[model samples]
Target: MIGVIKALYRTQLLSIKGIWYLFCSIRLVGMNLMALLYVRQKLCPRQIAISENGISINYCTLYTQSEHLAAQLAIHCDIKPQQKIAIMAGNHNILVHALFALARLGADIYLLNTELSATQLRDINNNVHFDWIIHDPEITWLPPINNLPTYHENQISVYALLTALPLTHQMKIEITHFAKITVLTSGTTGRFKLARRSGQAQNFVSPFFQLLVKLNLSHYRKIYIATPIYHGFGMATLCMSVLLGATMFLTRRFEAPKACQLIAHNKIEVVTLVPLMLDRMLTYSETRLQSLRCIISGGAPITATLVKQVLDRLGRVLFNLYGTSEAGICMIASPDDLAVYPTTIGKPLKGLCTKLVAKESAANMRNELYIKCAWSTGGHYWVATGDLADKDADGYYYLNGRVDDMIVSGGENVYPFELQQCLSMHPKVKDTAVIGVDDEEFGQRLVAFIVLASDAEQTEAIIFSWLKTMVARYQMPKKVIFVDELPMTEIGKVDRKKLRQLLS
Candidate 1:
């Protein structure tokens, strides 16, 4: 009876602490909003803000560079407040500077994917009609546009722009409203569309609080962001690191071995990456990961097998976050949660609520997840995520797969994620992707493409025999094809579209 009372008391204390943090977060939002107006003058001179390739950029230098670039955008590029500008650049210091500069001008900045082909970029621009296109000279794929004015880093130098224009203590252009930042969804299944987010005060504070409280981001002195800056996962970490005055280490692209080396060299406390990156890092030496206090994983589905492997090799520091560009981070699975419910995506964030709505075709209790939060899009109370999920008796949610990815085989529904998870546990299988193919008798049949581990002598017959013990007869793949490597999308997800093309 005493133990039960103690446990109840602890739970109540935690709830009270959560409420206190929420109140503090809301108050900080208002303070940060006011600080946005005079952001340039609020720089800390001695603190290192960003570190890239052994070069450290202090907050004072970051402010001066951003100011100079803001002047160039107004005077040379003829850019005005509220004008639309598209930025297509890699993860570089210059790109970070441009982001702050554009924010200062209150320009609607569209962050284009650096991996997009020239044709796709043109197609997107044709529909959006951007006022200015600022691109990196290293991006050679972009075709010259005759009508729009394009500027490169060389042509628009902050130093040159500052020298040509008179020094002014006050901002030359007054921005009445904060800028709206436009981020694009990964168009794996369909064409990408813009997800516009107004530069509201709460927009910044919510993520900051979420990271600080959930991921213990504030305690980490150095952070390595391995994902692309154009995506939400990478961009959020960058912003949070800057706000906390933490040293940020960035790379133009993610290389597993190099990333591990950077973490070891810089004594990085926190490292944020997707599952694919983590899988590759696991192959390298585990000693390189000793300095890390936390490893944040998101932006893709992670299998139970991979989660277990991370815990075994790197200690219990993995955190899996589930979210989308349309809906901000909905759930977070901590290390303790994953130890019990390995596949669970954990509970909802403090201010968010989630419900499972039954899919029209699903015979089981499984349903599509609908999230309601302040950051949800579509101007509705609840945003249908289109991803199917189910909650356990303890209220931990587990993702089955996307609704569209569900396959009906012989009148039995089979989720590819389930099959993929089962196959991934096989020692011989390094990576796996499952897709449904047309079948005259069953309506649709599952096909799996697998990448075998190095020096593993497993054949198709052996894998099939092993899988029989792992999954149900109907859940097993109708056909298994071995591959050298799985095709990946620009954002590091399995390219199912290209995989289907390979089948054809």
Candidate 2:
């Protein structure tokens, strides 16, 4: 009994030490990021920093072009301290710069999606109170007349407004000056949960970039961005790029072949993607990514097959960035980690704390992941991460997909992503989605929706062989339906709910 108790005590002590070490590491990364940003501000100052017109900003332009543009926009904003200003737009260089300028001016921002309908916009506006609306002329106008702004974006888009707007060095950064941004967690559907994060909460991205730099991610003089600017990943990435002195190429939406060509032609070194976008890029082998060094996948789980294909074809430059807008940036899979742990999401970001809790239900046991931030959005919303992960005995983390996405079959727990990754390995398979279907016997049965390559024709045996090799027997899908393409959400992810309805 004494031996067992002593061993348990030693184990508990080790766990505590690991957490402290992790926290210290994150503090160091944040410090490096802060120092680097200060350095760039001092030495790499430019009114309009850019790489080429192939990009909006080119090598000869100023590093602070977006900053200058924001200064001008701030004049129109008439923004005062403690006021909230909402920014909704497709990805644009000006939007990113404008946001920082807004922060500098001590105004809170509501980063919103432009895709919501006029009625939907009005509904959101009712819930999220904003003092001013600064957004794209096109999207802002899309809202219904009722949702129409008390202020207008079109007036500025016309004539020499860019010059006539506002230009003043009047931004002061104080804790009180930083207002919380209210972002809707669910995409315009169910009751909106506002993820209100302050400037201190939002500041983690700078350290994330610094950590990546330390990890030896190839720096991009010019980056091509395609995600909607209002979304967290898009908003977060654009903000972080500013500190790196990188020129940004912002697109309205994801365009597969064109995006590929842009990366090849523009020599875009760094880019962000979800799994769906990664699938599209991999399907067409036309793009030569010689200069591309980093591809950060977030917002969803990316499969091993996709990672392997990218590494095999593009010479191994894939990264996994794990975080939510509410949590700021947390864990990331470095390029080197991908080489060794083909399945893990790398290690925690320096200073970020992660733990594996026994997932408890009324009846079953599973692993629930808890990520505690060292500098997590430090107010109103500071709970541990809700996602679940299975930590190996060796301390690597394996994402078990989202808690809501898990399914039970024949008394065994099966993760949807575990099945999807298996089906995707088939040569005939182009992409795949797995969802749970009601079964009178088992409560839920696994069903797969697959997109096959246009050139290849295959039988069930071949597909099953692919699945059988990668996943365990019970995890194998009970049924498979091949489709021309999987249904996608507006934000570019597989719509599993829609798939379940169709199957039902």
Candidate 3:
């Protein structure tokens, strides 16, 4: 009850005036008018709502542009409500407009990852059977599908649509169907799975409130989403920023220096990024990031070293968010929580149920984490996160890497993250990742990939000797491969799959 009160206060929903305004806004949005127009009257016409890739658009322009774009889609493409359409593009103002436009048309939207291969895109299309595909011109490798209408940016003419007058009223398009949005899984280790969610504002209340109270998102008016919008983390921040009436700074791709410039120039108050991006951004000057009040890091694990660096350099402003594509957002560790335990993922959010399921015989060992939440893909039953975790006495959760990524060598289970964490403590080691491979004798053997510090002259023999002191003989990696750098996923996680392929 107290948590609810605090969330309400922090989100400005506790005051009578705030409640009344919210009530009015909800009522207006619930009416037959387009949903994006809810902010048309609330915000100033000249207030920039989106700034992406040198393009700035105010709320009025956003509404008008989306409306015009929706009309064009309806007239030219014969797009109808409930039709499943996939959008494959990076972050841009046109993509934002298309999202709003598609929402108004009540289309089942699938946000495709920009990093998807031609074959992966085809596989998704085979299952989804999309009515149309709207992609950017830069996506040149998209395979041609039979009877699937593909429209590039040039064919659509976004600038002309943005400059055109609003034709929604004249078009007389009746919006009776609500939309459902789907985001693809990271597919770092395996095939991609579609995580679906209802597009209603009511469905997002719990997660939004949790983030509002926990991250203090209501205070931030300038937000920089430094990750791909196709991913769940980026999509969530995009919706929340819009609901908060905040200005969003988006980029087609995340470049460390460019991100620093945007944040520094605009005085960006909050930023949503993956840990890899955060680490890269730290390589630049700290002065460029001084304006940040909240740095929301998610979509990948935040290493202890990264946590220490953030606290030491940026102060206590880093917030670590943990969730899966299937589960919206389960836990968030604040700066204070990290200060206490840098490895903790914090307590579960309000109204969320989390448990670690272990075997009856191995009750003391780490087990898979299960989450039951209103916003997750699992409606009522608990969903297995596939990631192994254990909770501390204080209810903070610590991840033990992916369950599939675990190695069973000589009848003993070995978690790669534990070995990686231990190996990273060496002063000469810059970065490291661990993977398991098939061994003729041990069934599976651990392989460690290392990136050494620039000034260090470290050898595999020295590191192996050092690691022997840290872990048991079975837990020690069979081989230590030195590399210039590790391959990273689109969201910045070390691509273990790629590492395994390197062995092949």
Best by lDDT: 3
Better of 1 and 3 by TM-score: 3
TM-score on alpha carbons, each prediction: 0.84, 0.75, 0.90
User: For candidate 1, what is the TM-score?
Assistant: 0.84
What are the runs in model 3 whose C-alpha is more than 4 Å off? 1-37, 143-154, 157-169, 359-364, 497-504
| Error at 31, model 1, angstroms | 9.5
Ranking by TM-score: 3, 1, 2
For candidate 2, the 10 contiguous residues with the lowest summed lDDT are 28-37
Model 2 lDDT on a 0 to 1 scale: 0.61
User: Tens-digit lDDT track for model 3 on 55-114?
Assistant: 787877777777778787777677888889888877778778888777777788898887
Off by over 4 Å in 1: 1-43, 138-171, 362-366, 407-414, 437-444, 469-475, 497-504
lDDT by residue for model 1 over 433-460, one digit each (tens)?
9999989988888999998888987777
Better of 1 and 2 by TM-score: 1
